[model samples]
Target: MKIAFYGSSLVSAYWNGAATYYRGLLRSLAEKGYEITFYEPDVYDRQKYRDMEPPDWCKVVVYEGTIDALKAAARQAAEADIVVKASGVGFQDDRLLEEVLGNASPRALKIFWDVDAPATLAELKSDPDHPLRQALFKIDLVLTYGGGDPVVNAYRSVGAAECVPIYNALDPQTHHPVPEDSRFAADLGFLGNRLPDREARVEHFFLDPASRLPGRRFLLGGSGWQDKPMSSNVNYIGHVPTRDHNAFNVTPMAVLNISRASMAENGFSPATRVFEAAGAGACLITDHWEGIELFLKPDEEILVARDGQDVAALIAGLSRQSAARIGARARMRVLADHTYAHRAREVDEIFRARLGARMEAAK
Candidate 1:
């Protein structure tokens, strides 16, 4: 299968969460014998911000110039077996959508793989000015990184021909327990970029817990969090490179998972961090969400916290033996059911279904 992935910064993970997701999925697809080409625009100083060099597993093509350049690039979409347009291309270019849908070959499968389903859906629902709302109907299939049944159903109701939830999963090879390092070792650690909508949730779930546990050290990693007023117990370490993520997770007593506001509101949207933490054999404390138990069994493979008090209580009560047990179980669960290989398989199945349907319609 020849697959062309159109997403934001597939070559650069620097401070972009979507970059890691794209790399994992594309690498997995390549392992499955798919010839993959990742098409990302050279925007946001992405050339300077690259974290991982293009893997030997697949090809990375960076598109330069204006919207017209991207439109010209869309001509390549004619040769692909599948063309995926992921959310957050980093620029507001409505023409990209029109070009992808209009220019794609009849044989090529067009997909809108939404990494940020909640935010996209919410914006489209409330705002008349949202650009991609009308474009959704043109795609053959819609896939989401997270957001369970509800999100899938909602997308379909809104004109998606079909919707599938390919939730975030672990890449065990990249994420596993490492020997404790003094730099990352802490009682609790939270890693995520700062966004306005997620700030309150961060304060409620992560920062508040650190404030309550003054004696225990808490570490913060991720971009755009420097100016925030953190408690004395919390130490901000700026951005941790994707390469060092496993080390960061493993060294912590317990890693914290905080969903963005849209994700929390939409439910079932676990960030890439959740899988990363689990894959690293790190005991995780996450804010409660409806479909969380589907991925990680609460109190068995994971711990759930509703608010600051819940988080503080969970941390204070977690014993070393208990934490180790939960961490092990979480890792086991991820390795068994939640890996990028598994996700790629799901995507392949969906593509087959869409292709079959198109053929049937033609006949």
Candidate 2:
């Protein structure tokens, strides 16, 4: 099968959180005999901060950030067996969505892949005239980053023919246990780009916990927050590149995962960092969410915290021995069940079923 995936960026993770997810899933899909072409617009300085060269698994088309260029890209993708427009492409997403669905071959399966389903659902609910809401009926399927039943139900309510949640999973080859570096050594570490909806939650789950545990060293790495006030015990390392993520995860005694407000409220939305940290055998302490057990067992493979107080207590009581044990268990659990290869198989099944049904109908 040929897949045309329009997304944020494949070569850069600079400001794009979905980069790893795309790489993992698509690489696995390519291994399954799918010819994939990823189309990313040359915007948001992503081309300037490219972390990776185009890989052999898929062809990358870095189009100019203009309407005419985008339309040409869309037309180029029209003949694929599956056409996917992912959310937050950092350009004229509305036009791209319309172009992909409008120009796609009648036999092609059109998909809207929402990386942030909770946030997208909130937009649709508040604004009846949202472009996605208006176009739902035309979409063959809605694939979510992960929101479990709530996200699926919400999309169905808005008229999606089918909705499925593809949760984040580890790409073991890309993320695995590595030797710890002193630079990232800390009691707890967190890496997430600052955004409006998640800043307050970061303060609650990360910043405040650092203040409460002043004796313990804390590390923070992300794009923004250079000016953000923090306790004297906190070490701020702005924008740790993708290459250093393994060291950042392994060196820290425990790594924290803070969900954006909408994701926490919606539940079942685990940030990519959660799996990355776990893949590196880093003990992960995450905020309370409904589906923690579905991925990792809390209080065993993972630790759950309700607020800053819980975070402080979890860190306070955690010993090096226990942290290592939890991390090892977490890594084992993900290796057994939540690798990208596992996710790719699920998606391949869906594609096969749909394509087979279409073939039967044609006969």
Candidate 3:
């Protein structure tokens, strides 16, 4: 099966969270005998911050961010078995959706893969001028990275013929335990970019904990956090490479996972970091979310923090042996049930089911 993706910069991981997800998913799919092509609008700066070079597993085409380039992408999509347009393409080229729907072959299944389901739904609900609303019905299927049953039903209500959640998964090879590095080694570490909607949660969950534990070392990584005033005990490592993630995860006594506004609002949405941290055998302390137990068994495989005080207490109280035990359990669970290979198989099943339904309808 030939599958093509139209989405944000897959070739760039600098300030690009979705790129890590895409690379892992597509790479796993490629390993499963699916021919894959990724179409990304060449945002020139990406060349400088490229993390993983285009692997031999798939063909990657970078086009100029223009109507002409989108037209070219549509032409390329015409030959694929499946063409997926993902959210957060980072450019204002809504016309690409039109060209893909208009140009793809009959056998080609067009999918709108929403990485940010809650944000997309909220925007569509509030903004009548949203360009993607009209295009939703035209796509053959809608797939989301997160958001549970409610999100799928809502997408169907908005005219998606089918909606599926292909939640985030770990890439075991890329994110496994590593020896600690002094630079990243911390009592607690939080790695996420700053967003206004998430600022309050970060303060309540992360910052407050750091302040409470004045003697313990805390670390903050990711972009847009340079200017944020952190306590003196908090170390700020701006934008660690995806390759360095495993070491970063393993170095910490416990890693922190904080959801954005959309993810927090839409429960069951575990970010890629959660799985990545688990894969690295890192004890993870995440802010409370419903359905977290469905992924990682709370209090057994992972720790949950309801607020900053909870975070501080967990860090201060847990012995190293206890932290290691939880981390090991979490890593085992994810490796068995939540790896990229598992996700690729799930996607393959979804594709087969869609095709089978189409065949049955025709007959």
Candidate 4:
């Protein structure tokens, strides 16, 4: 099957949190003999700060987000079996969705892949006349990164034909145990782009913990965090590339996962960092969120902190042996059940079932 996917940026994780997810899922799909063409808008200085080179596995088209470019993408997408437009697409997202969904062929399966399900659902629910509300009805399927049943039900409630939770997963080849890098060494670490939605949680779970344990070291990684006021114990490593993720994970004594407010409130939304840390055999401590047990067994595969006090206690008291044991267990669980290959196969299964049902109806 041929699939055309439109997203923020496939080549740069500069500000795009879903870059790793796209690369992993698309690469796995390519390996499975499905032809894939990725369309990414060149915006937000993503092209200026390119991270990964073009992939040989699939065709990646970097287009200027303009009316002409939108026309070109629609033309290219028309020939594919499936056309996907992801949420949080940097520029002109609503226009792109309208054009793609309007022009999609009857044979093409159009999907609205919402990586930020919580935020999207919130917007749609809060505003009855949101543009996405109309766009949602035009799409064939709605897929999410997290939010599980709650997200699926929310989408359905908002006029979606079918909704599925395709939660983020690990790509062991890209993220696995690596020798520690001295530059990233710390007692606790947090890696995420600085977004308003998550900064408060970061302050509560990571910065507040750092403030509490001034003697202990803390590390922060990712873009958009420059010039921020942090505690003396906290060090910022701007924009750690995906290639160095394993090293970054191994260097930190225990990796921290702070969820965006929308994701936390919505529940079941695990950040990409969670799986990345687990895959690299790094002990994970996350802010408390509902449905976490569905992914990781708290106190076994991972640790959960309700506040700064809990974070400080966890960071200060966690032993090396216990960290290693928990990390290893988490890695094993993710590798067995949550991987790009697993997600890719799930997409295939969904398509197969839909096709079979269509054939049966025709007969």
Index of the highest-TM-score prediction: 2
**Best candidate according to lDDT:** 2
Regions of candidate 4 where Cα sits further than 4 Å from its true position: 359-363
Q: In candidate 1, what are the lDDT values of residues 13-46, reduced to their tens digit?
A: 7656887677777788888888988878888777
Candidate 4 or 1, higher lDDT: 4
lDDT of 2 by residue, 35-85 (tens): 999999999899999999999999999999999999999997677999999
Local lDDT at 260 for model 3: 90
Query: What TM-score do all the candidates reach, one by one?
Result: 0.95, 0.99, 0.96, 0.97
- Say what the RMSD of model 4 is: 1.3
Residue lDDT tens for model 4, 1-363: 888898988888888899889988889888888888888888889988888888999888999868888778867877888889999888888888887777777777889999999889889999998888977767888989888888989899999999998889998888999898999989998899889998888888898889999899999998878888899999998988888889999888899999999999988888888999999999999999999998899999999999989999998899888999999999999999889999999988887777677667768
Q: Which stretches of candidate 1 lie over 4 Å from their true place?
A: 127-130, 360-363
- lDDT for 79 in candidate 4 is 81
The stretch of ten residues in a row with the least summed lDDT in candidate 4 is: 353-362
Q: Model 3: how far is 203 from its true place, Å?
A: 1.9
lDDT of each candidate versus the true structure: 0.84, 0.94, 0.87, 0.88
User: Ranking by TM-score, best first?
Assistant: 2, 4, 3, 1
Residue 24, model 1, lDDT = 77
